[model samples]
Target: MASVTLSGLRKEYGDLTAVDGLDLDVDDGELLCLLGPSGCGKSTTLRMLGGLETPTDGDVHIGDEPVTDQPPYERNTSMVFQSWALFPRKSVIENVAFGLKMDGVSEDERRERAREMLDVVEMGEFVDHDPTDLSGGQKQRVALARSLAIEPDVLLLDEPLSNLDKRLREQMQLELRNIHDAVETTFVHVTHDQNEAFTLADSIAIMHDGDIEQIGAPREVYDDPVSLFIEEFLGDTNLVDATVAEVTETGVIADTAFDTEVDVRTGDAAVAQGDGLSVSFRPEELDVERVEGTDGDGASAVTGEITDVLYRGSTVRFYVDLGGEHLFFEQSVGADTAFSAGDVVRVSWDPDDLLAFAADGARVGRGET
Candidate 1:
């Protein structure tokens, strides 16, 4: 396994830039995911790393070697595509050994290595099966085994499990993580699926408009986003519009869309009075209690009536109408005192749990408190 590095990497198509000047480092044997929406340059970056696309500028390094100019076959990297492009006419074992044969390994050695890789991917029993006869999940395992048979310094995965059913895809995510641990190969996976990245990657690099918005472990990025875009893209949360009413040493007092003033904890953010801001109240961070009436007056709590209750498998989501504005919170289905629609509830949260953003969508304050 080898470390991967990209320095000032860029890619363009005419006037449109697919990848801006980007810099990133992947530790040796680490599985780093390039995650983003479509048109965000994640796939393009992966293509560049695999030598499938030439960068408009900058360098690509695999370990100590500069490989920006190398062809796909010359680079010590193997790519598993989304389509799982297995040879239709070839047997599973033949397909797995094909790369080794191309490298001129003896027939017996290549076959032995192919069988070992098939076993590694739990496909040893299907070695002689036709690729066309295998199920989607089985075909994916064959494709992964074929890539691993090459014993590459780095493996590139381009949304390999996207074609399977949701259940199969989720199952494959765990198996893929286990396979990565076993092989210990440096991996760069590109995907737009948030849960997949969170499940498979050691580190996630979130991309936006051709550049990296943030890069960190799954929980770190989800809990402490650097901007409003990151916060909204990471998960579901209530964003209430407000204007800063007063700046205090601890944080700020802001008039919210719920027709109430709440103290928001902003740690050393350059905020002032009258500035328009959007405060994110994550559903999981809220505390809700069934109340009798809307006459309660608390700075940290708002009285609202439940407008809708959605039963989502093991959890329930409750949407509340705070005057004209709406906010939602979730609870486990097994929790005591389940609420229903039209129930009066009081929603409260700690001031420090709030995350405020400015008009330009930049996060207000240093997130470290």
Candidate 2:
């Protein structure tokens, strides 16, 4: 296991910067995920680390050694692609042993090590079966076993479960986490799947337009995003316009665009009077009911008419019209009560649950709160 570091790492294609001045530190034995949409340079960053692509400038270091000049084989890092890339003619055991064989290990030791790795990946029973006869998940297991057999310093997985169906993909995610824990290698995975990143990553680096927008644990980044892009991108949230009305010792007070002034007290922020700002709160944070009054828990309330309702399995999504503006609220149905479309309701939430961001979409610093 090793810690990987990139300093001012850049990659360009003519005038376009595919990866711009990227800097990151992936701790030893940590599973760091490079998460972003397509064309955000996540794959390019992973490739640069694996020595598959060279950076236009800056350094790639493993431990204390700068490996920007080294080749993939010389860097001692093994990569698993989205494609399984198993040999069709080779059985699982043979495929697992292929790398060790090429590295000049004795045949007896190679088979022993390959068998052990297959067992780790829960594919020991299929050691003698041809990979062509295996299902997609089984083939991916074989590929994982093959990658593990080499005992590389770092393991790079690029959307390793993208080819599987939903159920299989979910199952493989746990399996992959198990493999990582068993081996304890530094894993850097790249994917666009939000839940995949949240489930598997120790820390996530959210990239946008060839730059990192935020890097934090799943809950931290989700609950307190640093930008409007980060807030909306992480999950579904309500972004309502508001203005700073007053400042208090506990937090700040703001007036919403809908003529409703509420005491949104929380921590300090870089806000001033009359400054235009935006408030973000998740749908699940709101309390919805059929009245315009507060639930008497110091909860701020916004009353509106339910314009639309969509059933989504366990929960229902409600579109509330606050005059001309629309607010989305997600309510989990229980035996206690239920709601439907065209119902006039009041949405209540605590002041602490409200997040403040600047009009320019950047997060207000907590120091100024």
Count: clashes, candidate 1:
0
lDDT of 2 at 252: 70
What TM-score, over all chains together, does every model reach?
0.98, 0.92
- Report the C-alpha lDDT of model 1 over 43-93, residue by residue, as the tens digit: 899999999999999999999999999999999899999999999989999
TM-score of 1: 0.98
lDDT of each: 0.93, 0.85
**Model 1 stretches astray by more than 4 angstroms:** none
lDDT tens per residue, model 2, 252-307: 77788766776665456657889888888678788777874434323288787888
